[model samples]
Target: MKPSETVLEIDLKALEHNYRYLASKVDDNVKKLAVIKAFAYGSDSVALAKKLESLGVDYFAVAYTQEGIDLRNGGITQPILVLHPQSTHFQEIIDQCLTPSIYSEFVLNHFIASAEANQQKNYPIHLKLNTGLNRLGFDPKEVPMIVEKLKQTSSIKVDGIFSHFAASEDVKEKEFTHHQMDTFKKVSDQLIENLGYRPLRHLCNTSGILNYPEAHLDMVRTGIGLYGYGNSKEVDQQLIPIGTLKTIISQIHNIKKGESVGYNRMFNASKDTKTATLPLGHADGINRIYGKQNTNVSIHGNLAPIIGNVCMDMIMVDITGIDCEEGDEVILFGKDKSAEVFAHNAGTISYELITSISQRVKRKIIP
Candidate 1:
């Protein structure tokens, strides 16, 4: 409630709804793992994870060791999987009872050594097989060796095996997704057979859970969808966005024709118009791309186009001929039809749009 400060409202009911919907997609054989990484994709991880925990999420997934530690520090009892494991934090990881996704032999060996040094026994670790993303995880050829290495470690436990799908919403490119699933399954089978371990096998993400029933092996990790941002237009239509970014219109002014606004004179009023500057800009996670073509806001339920380069703490929207005044409500992003719509206008994804929202914006859970 300070000037230039912003607030984001998260709907817990909508989050619960998204979870139940994704859960409905899972076959009876598959468990649900809620992806609470990146601060629940920038929407208060602790609050959201606590809610998902209460909603019966079978597991929790984070991108790093620190994220898992944050959840543990917050008193989360559900199993937390760190999708990306760092060798340096293996000690804290073991000390905190965090489950890490072991990808490379180097990191795996380090984890093994750390576990042994700490006198750990049967510590659970997830195996990530790199099917296609090429970003992280082990190659299929390395699975057998990984299995062999794991068998040599007494203090570590291979609790789960999984992979990430690059594309699942594009029904037209089902081949790519199918290939990823098939490859992951083959590697997982090889790993388990070679090591004689069957911990828990999982491969589907949010989009993957909706489109590929067979890929939901053992557990399904729901991230954006759990936060109510389905990747595709069709799937996105099925759910309500849970977060809404709002700020006050700090001031309004009339700019004559040819008058410039904001920095660099990037936007000029083509016609005499009324503009309102709201307390949100790139500094608050409204990316600069939303400045011209992608910017739009809701005022009195009517959408207005953004008129200038987004300043550090403010943006100008043409409210020409609209009823507006200072201290009025302005929806910068989230549940407002404008934000997601603007993302498409800027040729970007909803995850970038929502998660990019700055933490300075007070995030509150709506009961």
Candidate 2:
């Protein structure tokens, strides 16, 4: 029997399956860094990190310093790379033994000062290269200046040099992707020569690991793939989505023709209709875009279209022909019920859908 309340079931077995599948694609020599940022893409980050640690994952990464601190508090002893560290939390980062990705000259200088003030020597840091992302990273032309600063500071050491792909998943952007890769390699090589030592080189993201095998380098970072999405239908087949969102029909309503339902009468019944109300709504991450029959939920193995405007805590689905009643199990997205499909119907993606799941929803981990 399914739980009465809205619940997100995180399946560890499926997570392991996805991990093993991705690991199989890489060589034994290359290290695998699991991207656990955004609460592991909106699933339990600490829980998932611990599981990946036990599986011998080489490293873990998070977006912010607090996220890394949370993992440390949760007993994740694995090395965590704070992808976007702020100057204010530099001391906390060092105290917690978390590595910071030094992206720009400002970040680099600030981290050095913090490490020195703490009397730390040879603190590990990763240099972020721009490589066409145009987001956060040092331009390739800045390699000389970056190395000069590194020489002046003994407080921090270059542990790794990495960059993000602009579009590894799209074959149409192959030229741009390769240019990014080549630029990373050239800049990395230049930095290595200037520093007189080779740090770990990692540039491939999830799609890069699959599409551009040669660029796997010394390590690869994967986020979406680990959560069972390959960014494409063909690749997604080889992965298993780990999070299953389920809820129950809170109430059922029968309306006659010419009756209207929900806020502002957004859904008007032209014929007699039966509707099932679910406990989850936009507050739980089912965006308002999914309402008005844009998507559906699985009830009694029947697809029921969501009707009317989605409320803050509820959504009504048309279940006129479905064999379901109040309190019946509702599968929002899981197993054969694809989250990708659910998100695409509303001009979104699984990453947003899964990560947007409100923390208030009950989480049940299937170990």
TM-score of every candidate: 0.96, 0.99
**lDDT by residue (tens digit), candidate 1, 1-367:** 4324468889999898888888888776678898888889888899988998898888999988899999999989989998887888888888788898888989888888898898888889888889998888998888667867877878888899888888787888799998998898788888778766688988888888888887777888889897777877787777778888888788999889999888898888788988898877888888788887466887778788887787888889889878878988887666647346768877787788887888788887897
Give the 10-residue window scoring lowest on summed lDDT in candidate 1.
332-341
lDDT of 1: 0.83
Q: Clashes in model 2: which pairs?
A: none
For model 2, what is the C-alpha lDDT against the true structure?
Answer: 0.93
Off by over 4 Å in 2: none
Off by over 4 Å in 1: 1-5, 336-338
Model 2 lDDT tens row, 64-126: 999999999999998899999999999899999999999999998899999999998999999
Deviation (Å) of 111 in candidate 2: 0.7
lDDT of 1 at 322: 81
For candidate 1, the TM-score is 0.96
